[model samples]
Target: MLVKTFRGAFVCTALGLALGVLYGGWTALGVVAILAVLEISLSFDNAVVNAGVLKKMNAFWQRIFLTAGVLIAVFGMRLAFPVVIVAITARLNPYDAVHLALTDKDRYQQLVTDAHPAIAAFGGMFLLMIFLDFIFEERDVQWLRRIEQPLARLGKVDMLSVCIALVVLLVTSFTFATHAHQEGGVHADKGQTVLVAGIAGLITYMIVGGLSGFFEDRLDDEEEREQEAEEAAARTGRSRSAVVLAGRAAFFMFLYLEVLDASFSFDGVIGAFAITNDIVLMALGLGIGAVYVRSLTVYLVRQGTLDDYVYLEHGAHYAIGALAVILMVTIQYEINEVITGLVGVVLIGWSFWSSVRRNQALTAAEPDSEAAARVSVP
Candidate 1:
């Protein structure tokens, strides 16, 4: 099972390393390996969150995610995104931006760093919305009962998540973003930029997520109608299978996943400069890491890992909430990537341990319950 799941990841890793060596010999190879590890460590929770969404999609769409989606992630986000950011932030043409990225990597890196405030604000708020919506909605399984129970109850209030998110955006924009701008002495209207970017993030989440849910409901209704039609056909001795394509529902979900991935990649993209500024190397390394993440997501879904470990989703969301907070703080402060990665690992590890304990307790109780039932029967 492991081999079957990770086969593509292994292949990608080999090709990435080979490309790294061809690009700049042994030094580049080492950088590529480190970057790949860094991406995986930082994005483990992203895989979990993705699994939760991907499992709901059909096989054909899943293939699309693994294929076309990989191209977008590797090239579009890892390569083209930073170039576009540099182009916009530095007020350069697309050709010059590409040239700068290739010829003057230091300047390229600096411009991307200058653009960090808006990037952090946008990605932070989008991730915050994801975390907020998850925590607010009531679920049958609660990971942190003491906290989740109260939040779930409060979730009954209309638009509570949105309200809280807006408040956070406002406070951070006025305080951290303003302070960062003054400190950096670059953009005088940094606070305003942050505000607008954050709002754009919020609206993007609403439109993409809202459309996905809307179409999902439509798909469900259609499936129910199809099921009824099939039953009627069976009763009339003309039974036929009903095939419901994922259609628009899957498309929106795919779009949502890509946006979610881009948000998750923002930090990694910036942080990769700490290792090297070669955009090609960054794409190769991060691309390899992304393949492994996609593989892990597929593994989780196929193995029913989320179903078996009920609180895994809870932990992933909690980690996402922590990341969202970290991103917001990073608007003004420089946080260690090590710290960011550790937070996610620790949260997910803790949740997995809790799940195992719960399973053990249930297993232990089953025998006693069976014995009691036997005695009562007598």
Candidate 2:
């Protein structure tokens, strides 16, 4: 099962390494390997979150995710997106941006770094909304009951997540973002830039997430109607099932997933400069890591890992929340990518351990409960 799931990842890793060696010998190979590990560490929680969404998608859409979605992730987000950012921020044309990336790698990296505030704000808010919406929504399996219960109760208030997110944006825009600009001697209104970018992130999330939910709800309604019809036919000696996701619903869900991936990749793209300024190497390395992440998502869905370890999703979201906080902090201060990666690993590890303990307790109680039932019968 593992081999079947991860076959593509292994192939991609070999190709990426070979390209690395051809590009710059052993040193580039090492950098490529480090960048690949960096992406995996930064995005392990992304696989968990993605599994939750991908499981809902149909098989055809899943294939699209692995195929076209991978192209978009690798070239669009990892490569083209940075070029676009540099183009816009540095006021260069797309060709010039690409030229700059190819020839003047250091200048390209600095331009990308200069764009970090807006990028961080946008990605940070988008991820924060994801974390907020997850925590605020009520779920049957509560990982941290004491905290989640209260938040879920408050979630009954409409748009509570949006409200809280707006407040956070406002506070940070005026405080951290503003302070950073003043301290750095940047002449522009950094606070305004952060505010606009944050709002854009918030609105992007609302529109994409909202439309996806709307289409998904429509699909659910269709499924319910079809199930009723199937039941009626069953009474008349027939059985039928319908595809739940199709047409508009599947498209929107695909869009949602792509947007989510872009948001998750923002930090990793910026952090990659810390390792190396070679755009080709970064794309190769991070692309390989993304393949593995997608494979892991498939593995989780096929194996029912999320169903078995209920708290794993919760842990992933908490890690996302931590990352959101880290991104926001990074607007004013530098954060080591190692710290970001470790934070996610620790949270996910803790959740996995907790899930194991819960499963063991449940298993141990089963025989005792059966014995007690037998005693009562006697």
Clashes of each: 0, 0
The digit string of per-residue lDDT tens for model 2 on 1-378 reads 899989988999999999999999999999989988999999999999999999998788888888899899999998899899988887789999999999999988888888888999999999999999999998899999999999999999999999999999999898888753431234678788899999999999999999999999999998888889988999999878665456689899889989999988987898999998889999998899888888898899989999999899999999999998898889889999999999999999999999999999999999999999999995
Candidate 1: tens digits of C-alpha lDDT, residues 316-350: 99999999999999988999999999999999999
Candidate that would win on TM-score: 1
Judged by lDDT against the true structure, how good is candidate 2?
Answer: 0.90
Candidate 1: C-alpha lDDT: 0.90
The window of 10 residues in a row where model 1 has the poorest summed lDDT is: 179-188
lDDT of each: 0.90, 0.90
TM-score of 2: 0.96
Which lDDT value does model 1 have at 131? 99
- TM-score for all predictions? 0.96, 0.96
lDDT of 2 at 289: 88
